[model samples]
Target: MQVGGKSQTTWQPLGWTGASGGGRVGERRWRLVDVAASAGISTQQVRNYLADGLLPPAGRTPSGYRMFTERHVRALAVARRMAEGHGWARTREVLAAVHRGELPAALAALDAGHAELDRERAEIARVLGAFETVLDSPAAAVPRRDARIGVVAAQVGVRTSQLRLWEQRGLLRPHRQRGTGYRVYDVAEWRAAQVVALLRRGGYPFDIITAVLDELRSTGRPDRVRAELARREQDLHARSLRRLRGSAALSDYLAETVPAGTH
Candidate 1:
C-alpha cells in the first residue's frame, strides 16, 4: 500500500511471501490513509480494529501519530480472511492471541471453530437419515375434508395435547377456521405433522426434527428435500475450506513475523 495520488492509494503486495521462516520482514512504514485505501476501509475502521485488538498494535512516530507498517497491513489482511471463515467472534480471539505471541492459543481457537463445523455436519447427516427413515410412513387421512386438530391427532397417532405442544414450540402453524376458532390443518400441514410424528417416533429431539420439517416444508418434494440437504452439506464443506485457508495464512504470518528462536 502506497501513500500518494489516487492511483497510488490502492492495495499492492507490501511483500509477504505467505510462507514460513521469513522472520521480521518488510521494513516499509505505511501511511494510515494508504493502509485504509488498500484495505478498502475507512481510517476510523482501522483505528477501531486496533482498539478492538483485531490487529497488532501499530507503532507510534516521534510526533505521536500512529505509525502504520507493512506488518499491520498483513495482519489486517489476515484478520479479514479469518473473519470471513471463522466468524467475527472467533476471528477476534485468533487475532488477539496472535498479537499476544500466543500462537498455540490462536491455533486452538481455530481448532474449536472447526470442531463446531464438524458437529454441525454430523447433525445434518443425522437429520437426513431421519428423513429417510420416516419417508415411507403413511399420513393418516382426515375423516372428512376438515383436517382439524383432533382429526390430525387421530391420524398421526398423537395426543391432542402433543399437537398443541408442537404448535407452541413453533413446529406447527395450522390456520384457524373462521367463526369457530378451531385450528385447521391443510394438506401441507398434514404432511408436516406426518414428518413430526415419524421423527418423534424415532426419538429425535425437536431441534433435529425441526431441520427435517423445514426442508420438507420449503421444498414440498422428496427429491427437492434431498437436494436442499445436499446443498447444506456442500456449504459446510466450503466453510471448512475457508477456515483452513485462514489458518494457513495466520501460520504463515506468525512464521514471518516472529524472530527466530523466540516462538
Candidate 2:
C-alpha cells in the first residue's frame, strides 16, 4: 500500500508514526530462550541486552513470564550491527532513546556519529595540506648524522627546554649518548622535531602533531605522505560504509516494530 507517496512495508503497522521496538499486533510470540537461540547468544546475554536497553521491551504471559517475538530478535541483530559501526557506548545511547519512544534523540545520536567522522576526514585533509607545506619548507630534510639537543633546538629556532618538554610529552623521542647522558637525535628523530616545530608554529595541537609525525616517521620521505593519507582515507571510507549499513538495518528493524503505546 502507498501512503503519502511512500510505499508501506508489511512489518510496519498500518501507520508507524510513533517510535521504535515492540511486536506488531498478531505476530506469534516466542520464548526468550528462542529469541536468544535465533541470534546465537546466550539467554543471560540477551537478558543483559534487555537490561542495557539494547533490545526493546518483551511481551508478558498472563502468568507473568516474559514473551518475545521476531521484533526483539531483529532489535538484537540490528543493535549488534549498530555497535559494530557506532561503538557500544553510542549504540546504547541510541537504543535507550529508542526504547523510551524518543525517535528524534535516537536519530540525533546517529547523526552525531556521522558528524564526528566528517570532522575526522576534515582533519585528515587539513593535515595533508599542512604536511605538504612543511615538506617544501626548511624542515624538508634531515641528515643521518647525530646532533645534540642544543644544535637541533637552534636549527628549529626553538628553545632547548621546549624540546625537552616535547620529549616529556612523548611528542618525540631522541637517543642518549652511552656515557655522556646527553640527548642526541639522528635523521628520523630530527625530522620529527622539525615537523613538530613547524606544526607548533602553525598552531597545531600536540595530539594532531603526534599523529602527523607518527605517519611521517613511517617512511621519512616527503613522497610517501600522500600514500599514508590515501590509506587513511580508505579507512574512513570503510567506517562510513559500516555506519551506512547499520542505518539501513535499523530502518528495517524499526519498520517491523509496533508503534509506541499501541501494544
**Candidate of highest TM-score:** 1
Best by lDDT: 2
Superposed on all Cα atoms, model 1 deviates from the true structure by an RMSD in Å of 10.0
Q: What is the TM-score of each candidate against the true structure?
A: 0.76, 0.74
Runs off by more than 4 Å, candidate 1: 1-26, 37-44, 101-105, 138-144, 257-263
C-alpha lDDT of residue 169 in model 2: 92
- 53-106, model 1: which lDDT tens digit per residue? 787767666777777777789889988988888888999998887766566677
Give lDDT tens digits, candidate 2, residues 244-263. Answer: 88888877766655455432
Looking at model 2, residue 244 earns an lDDT score of: 86
lDDT of model 2 at residue 114?
Answer: 89
